[model samples]
Target: MPATPSTILVVEDDDIVRMLIVDVLQELGFSVLEADGSARAIELLEDTNQRIDLLMTDVGLPGMDGRALAQKARELRQSLPILFASGYADTVEVEEGMAIIGKPFSIDQLRDKVKSMLGI
Candidate 1:
């Protein structure tokens, strides 16, 4: 039997960027859940019983930033893989065991990074 597609929770404040990421992840055969900010993302995380394989979020977000969100998410789901997307590379530091993809990344780059993180 084939394994189920990994579910990724994407938290991006920009609408266009979030749409693009969702489209790419869907096309790449992974299930995607999108949120425009940290609050919504946390709501989804708290409400879902399904297994989420990854959390891809922007470093800058309104209300609760991505780093705070990632920390909260890890509390909810231990050792959840995270990919922090940021346009400001100089300000963003990649955490241990967590992945970071700069903004304006190509579809292949996003797919490759997610695949490597998920061990797909």
Candidate 2:
């Protein structure tokens, strides 16, 4: 039997960017959940029934920001994997267990990084 596709929660402030990412991820055979900002993302994260396998968030988000959101998420789901998408990827530093991907990444790069993180 085939394994179930991993579910990724994508938190991005840009509507078009988020849509493109969601489309690309869905096309690549992964289940995707999207949130425009930290508030909605937190609501989704708080939902116990949701099986979120990974969190891919933009680092330059408004209000709470991606790092803060990741910290809050960890409080709720300790083992959750976080992937920060940043425009300044080379300079971005993540926590020991977290990862980073540069902004304007190619479809292939995004796919590879996400799959590698999820081990899918």
Candidate 3:
């Protein structure tokens, strides 16, 4: 194992879902940060001391949705990899160095997606 595990920031509005995702990532041996919305996510993102290897977020947030949050996150940390979890709505468009995972993903799928995004 590497000296330090990669860290991921996960943003989702649902508390249960967020816990489930964080649990899986922890089982996979990654350090994770959780935020229920963009406001908290921005706080974590803006803290330069935090080491975030990837961002995985739900696209449909209450305010300051995931896409906008991602834009802001990019402004704070250039080249940070981002993954969006959407229900596959037609409106969600992924940009370069970013990816999207459909909602209700299996644990294996989530694991694969995160690892693929992190290039592990």
Candidate 4:
């Protein structure tokens, strides 16, 4: 039997990048929820009906960067898995058990990283 699609929250300020990631997630059989910034992402989380299984956010954003957003999201959803993607290696540091995917990643890399994070 096939596995169920995981619900993912993608926080990205760039429209192109956000769309690309959303498309990729959809193609990989995951239900994607998008937000342009930290505020919107937080709002989505606060919605009573929504439940995000994972968070994939870009480290560099306009206002609240991925770190701050992840921190806030963690407060709300303590056990949610996070995958921080960044162009710069030093920009997004992985926490105790979290992981980081460097930007310009290929489809395979993204899939592998996500599967590993999700333990699929």
Candidate 5:
């Protein structure tokens, strides 16, 4: 049997960027959940019973930030992979089991990075 498509929770404050990311991930055949900020992302993480394969978040969130969100998310799901997207690459540190995708990424770049992270 074919493997199930992985579900990714995307946390980004920018509405247009978040929508674009959701569309891209969906087009690439991955399930996606979206949040406008860290609080909502954490709320979703705490509330959902569904399996979330990855957490993709922006580094510069309005509150709590992506690193903190990732930490909390790991507490909720220990093995969940994280992908950090940022415009300020110099300031963001990449953690273990985490990948970084720079902002202004093309569809192919995002698709490839996500696929590699998920090992699909």
Candidate 6:
């Protein structure tokens, strides 16, 4: 059987980077949702109609930051998977089981991480 399409929430403050990641995922045939910041990303994840298979967010964000957002999201949905991406990923501490993709990533890196997280 073919795999189901997974709705992925991408939270990034940088428009270019966000678009790049979205383009890569879309090219790989995955469903995508975007949010410029943590608050908006939370809104998408909390939407009853949306079933987010995974969340891919930048580590540095204005106001709520990605770590806090991921923590809060974990509280709301324990089964949700999260991946953090940043140029300064080493500076940010994250939980176990959560993956981190460094900035300046290749399309292959992003695709592989998403696939691993989604267990594809």
**When superposed on Cα atoms, how far off is each prediction in RMSD?**
1.7, 1.2, 1.2, 1.5, 1.6, 1.4
Top-scoring candidate (TM-score): 2
Q: TM-score of model 2 relative to the true fold? A: 0.96
Estimate, for each residue in 1-120, the C-alpha lDDT of model 2 and write its tens digit. Answer: 127889999999999999999999999999999999999999999999999999999999999999999999999999999999999999988896689999889999999999888776
Candidates in order have lDDT scores of: 0.89, 0.94, 0.93, 0.87, 0.89, 0.88
lDDT tens digits by residue: candidate 1, 1-120 = 127889999999999999999999999888899999999898888875866889999989988999999999888877889999988856777666588998889999999999889877
Candidate 1 residue pairs in backbone clash: none
Q: What is the lDDT, from 0 to 100, of the residue 27 in candidate 2?
A: 97
- Most lDDT-accurate candidate: 2
Worst 10 residues of 1 by lDDT: 88-97
**TM-score, every prediction:** 0.92, 0.96, 0.95, 0.92, 0.93, 0.93
- lDDT per residue for candidate 5 within 1-120, as digits (tens), equals 127788889999999999999999988888899999999898888976876888999988987999999999989888889999999766777778998899889999999999888887
Candidate 6 Cα deviation (angstroms), residue 70: 0.3
- Which runs of model 4 end up more than 4 angstroms from their true locations? 1-3
Candidate 6 wrongly placed segments (more than 4 Å): 1-3
Return the clash pairs for model 6, or none.
Answer: none
Candidate 3: where are CA atoms >4 Å away?
89-91
Clashing pairs in 2: none
As a whole number from 0 to 100, the lDDT of residue 60 in candidate 2 is 91
